[model samples]
Target: MKQVVENIESKPSTPILGHVSPSDVECMEEIAGENWNEDCAVYAFHSESLFIIPKQRNIKLSLATLKSEIYTISPIRVFDQNIRFAPLGLLRWSSRSRGLHHGTHRMHNKNQRKRLWPIWVLLEH
Candidate 1:
């Protein structure tokens, strides 16, 4: 993981154009000659082989989340304009375990249960 981060940081930063479009994804699928799958496409995008512009806002949030180690990728919403290109994920167990304070003991207790929130990665359609 450290090596991966170092590699990314060492590379010259390129301005990410924008989120992948549906047509672009279709083109990639066509170019892949029928071997394409959602998993492979996703990996390609993350690996930078697919070349969609990174959403700058999401990038910042993603970096912060990575450093905090508090979230996990959930899913990509294909057609939703509000959340198309986003790092959709769930909060980590440890993060969720941090309970709210300044309330009753039962409410503030670390042992108090919490549910994982669904994170949406908004992208352009």
Candidate 2:
């Protein structure tokens, strides 16, 4: 996980509207111990202006992909300011099908909700 994080951080940032391959998603999923369907291509957005929300507070990193549908991979915690090492929390958004699905573990408590509110805010924005 550390190696993956280091690799991502060391590589040059992709353009704002660049592409992310299925292999990249697969690699991330493997590192994060999550299962992400890599059947379709993924797009990458390198937003220099967008930081984690909940200003001045600790927030997790999130990656949004819109290949087959809109889904987000948000970490439970920030891993040394790099997202690659953070444990994953999957959020699936499907309008035509079922609505939002929050599949995060241990997020049913008030304290967990408080910590995750910033991620929701950032996703909405």
Candidate 3:
């Protein structure tokens, strides 16, 4: 089912949503075929695409394809999860394959009860 919103309703201009809502899907379709802008960027966390909605029907975008770039944690590419400042460094993460904070979110003391000491050292130190 396709629902269209002729005029956007009240919502966060920049919502750090966990998923791409149904409206976002419709918006994506519209942007894809009808009125996509380049300067306006869409943060589709659910769909895992960073849309660059500029001012036309065809905007720059990053949709999940087989060849989509995968940002990963390697010994060289990203900082180690055990580094001294790893906790402070985890302010915001951007990825295409996973939703925001899918894997690296902060846990509560209950969850932390099961972790090893070194892991806590990284998070608390």
Candidate 4:
């Protein structure tokens, strides 16, 4: 896959959505690789971690081709600042551990509310 990286300095403050930086955008782009796009909105934290919500969750603004196979919409954690898909397919969980290239793992089936589950937040959510 191919990704497009933009060199925007400041983070974008999307009023209703909150603040997201160029570095965050760059990180998501890198992960989705050929699948990334500008419209993609990401949830990033101070720990330099991120969560992905799609380009436009509601409609026409919807992507022509739904790329990710996993139905849940949890964001992958990309730490090394590198992008790579996990080997195992965690339908609803994030990677078991942190860092890049370390693929997703099986999800804990305690409850089924979160479409996508982040490994760390599994206990709380």
For each candidate, what TM-score against the reference? 0.18, 0.20, 0.18, 0.19
Candidate 2 to native Cα RMSD, angstroms: 18.2
Candidate 2 residue-wise lDDT, 10-124, digit = tens = 4444333433233334454444344322222121223312222221233223434432323233323332333322222234322111222232333356554533321121221
- Top model number, lDDT: 4
Q: What is the C-alpha lDDT profile of model 3 across 3-49, one tens digit per residue?
A: 88698586634422232222333343443333222233344344454
Q: Pick the candidate with the highest TM-score.
A: 2
Each candidate: what lDDT?
0.30, 0.30, 0.31, 0.35
Between candidates 3 and 4, the one scoring higher on lDDT is 4
Q: Which ten residues in a row have the lowest lDDT in candidate 2?
A: 116-125
Model 1 CA deviation exceeding 4 Å by range: 1-75, 80-87, 93-116, 123-125
Q: What is the model-wide C-alpha lDDT for candidate 4?
A: 0.35
Q: List the residue pairs that clash in candidate 4.
A: 2-34, 52-75, 86-103
Per-candidate clash tally: 10, 0, 11, 3
Q: Which whole-number lDDT from 0 to 100 does residue 47 have in model 2?
A: 32
Pairs of colliding residues, candidate 1: 18-53, 74-88, 74-89, 83-122, 83-123, 84-122, 84-123, 85-122, 85-123, 86-121
Who is ahead in TM-score, 3 or 4? 4
> Which residues of candidate 2, in runs, are more than 4 Å off?
1-17, 32-98, 103-125
